[model samples]
Target: MRPVASVSFDDLLRAHQGMIRAFLRRLCRNDALADDLAQDAFLIAHQRLGDLRDTGAAKSWLFQIAYNVYAGHARKHARRRELFEAQNGADLDDAAQPAPAGMARDIAMAMDQLPADVRACVLMCLSYGMSHSEASKASGLPLGTVKSHIKRGTEKLRAFLHAYQQA
Candidate 1:
């Protein structure tokens, strides 16, 4: 078999850094942690570049690596709640940083109330500007299921916002 061509890691990072950061942020809900995880994803990508057969599929391959890293981090995190608690204590003051504010906070709270599947669908579609098919693939849901979740999630968000306005 022909050896894989050497790919420029810098070029790959420049092309996909923002997408990786945003995806990690959505998955983890912590900007600093997301940045760290995104970097880790890139490191993994660089290490495994030889395994990549199709340069055109780099985006999907990178994301799959990111998803795996995020999943592993989450699993390890769950196994070490005490470590998280200690970190949480250290970061309590940082938590007081001015929140999203006003309508944005309201919307975020409403979104937080959604079922996980619905929330993922809404964020992938609205935040990331992904089409239903793309969101479905990213979220690991069926296309129809992703569409339904987005529709229902949006309706719930609107109702919550409307009720909040009236109160």
Candidate 2:
């Protein structure tokens, strides 16, 4: 088979752009950041195109790279936030937003409290309608782990929403 690098990078961008953006949005929870990450992902993919083995696996491979980029960005920003908070002695709610109605926002807030890996599994399975196996592949987690995370994440979200309603 011909090398993927031999193909037009623009064609790859056009094909996988939406998936990359959605993946980044879920990871970063910010549309602007997601857009920036999506562009970066495509650039990285283009640069590494020759490394891609299976054309059929290109979508998943691209998503994996995007996930890694978002995870690294999140970790770096988290450290920055800690430093800023230490310097200012004031908590910054960079993520604060007007709560949406009903149970959805409550559920999302609960999901936000989860560990990153668990949250990614939950979002991939519930929000994006991925199967456990698909989520496993996308997240680089085992299928059983993906299922467990979804089950626990759902239970936690439900409990959180119930508590919110009681409040």
Candidate 3:
């Protein structure tokens, strides 16, 4: 693996940043988060550019790095979600504040009703814009399981929201 020259690395980063960010956004569904991951991926690639011998493979190399970043972020989110559940997320903050009297609070309250796995799948697939396969990969579930979770979760959310609106 030969190190990419600084000048070449600069050009590579410029040319590929948008593409990497777009790919990450498809997986993450959050533009800000996707952009952050893209920056991290580029930084890592710059640090490891010397280890890569094939400049022609730059695009693939950068994408591989981006995937690694996304996977790592998924694992971290899972851990945090577990910790939040264990500690009771409400006890941390959402509980301490008086519930805002509005749709936001209603939605949040409704979201709290969802089972953790279902919620995770919904956020990843529907809210975040991840494809079903990508959500399955991130959630470490079977493809069928991911699909099932999303289907059931959305139905529940729909019902919950409808009830809230009626109230």
Candidate 4:
């Protein structure tokens, strides 16, 4: 395997930025916030590039960093989130950018129903096409837990979008 030093960080950023931002957007349900978090994640990844063991695994490594960054933000803002929810009578998802219609809307709603960790797992696997093991690594979830989250999250989405299936 090539060391991370073999692949320039700029190349990595160019290749993975869109996917990483999309993953963050789905997790946070906010476009602007996702952009900010993605930038932060990339910044951290650049700072820690020396720590990456293999260039081939950069995507997963970046994902892991992004997930951790998001988690940190969530933890740091937990009380603020609660206050916002209390005042707005809605979760942050409700305050996110306007969602698309039809199945997209349904999927977003269903995803919102998932716990953050489960949602992260599901997005990493289904949305980004990461393998279960890759998702496990990225999410810092046990392999079995990542598998379970994907299964259950898929089931929930399927159930929620069942009407679309019939239509």
Name the top TM-score candidate.
4
Worst 10 residues of 2 by lDDT: 90-99
| Candidate 4 lDDT score relative to the true structure | 0.88
lDDT of 2 by residue, 88-135 (tens): 875343353345676767665666688778888877777766678777
Better of 2 and 3 by lDDT: 2
Q: Which lDDT tens digits does candidate 4 get at residues 3-78?
A: 5557888998999999999888888888889999999999999899888889888989999999999999999988
Give lDDT for model 2: 0.74
Ranking by lDDT: 4, 2, 1, 3
lDDT of 1 by residue, 1-167 (tens): 33347557787899989988877766566778878899999999989887777666566667667777877787687646556568675432124234678887877668767865677678767876667876666556689998999999999988997899899
Local error of candidate 1 at 163, Å? 2.9
**Stretches of candidate 2 exceeding 4 Å from the true structure:** 1-8, 86-104, 160-167
Cα-based RMSD of the predictions, in order? 4.9, 4.0, 8.1, 1.5
Better model by TM-score, 2 or 4? Answer: 4
**What tens-digit string does per-residue lDDT give for candidate 3 at 1-167?**
54545437788888878767866654554667788898999899889877667665566566668877977887778767578878775322232234546787777666657765676677666764677877666557789998999999889889987887798
Assess every candidate by TM-score.
0.66, 0.70, 0.47, 0.92
Once fitted onto the true fold, the runs of candidate 3 whose alpha carbons sit more than 4 angstroms away are 1-7, 82-167
Supply the global lDDT for candidate 1: 0.74
lDDT head-to-head 1 vs 4, winner? 4
By TM-score, how accurate is candidate 4? 0.92
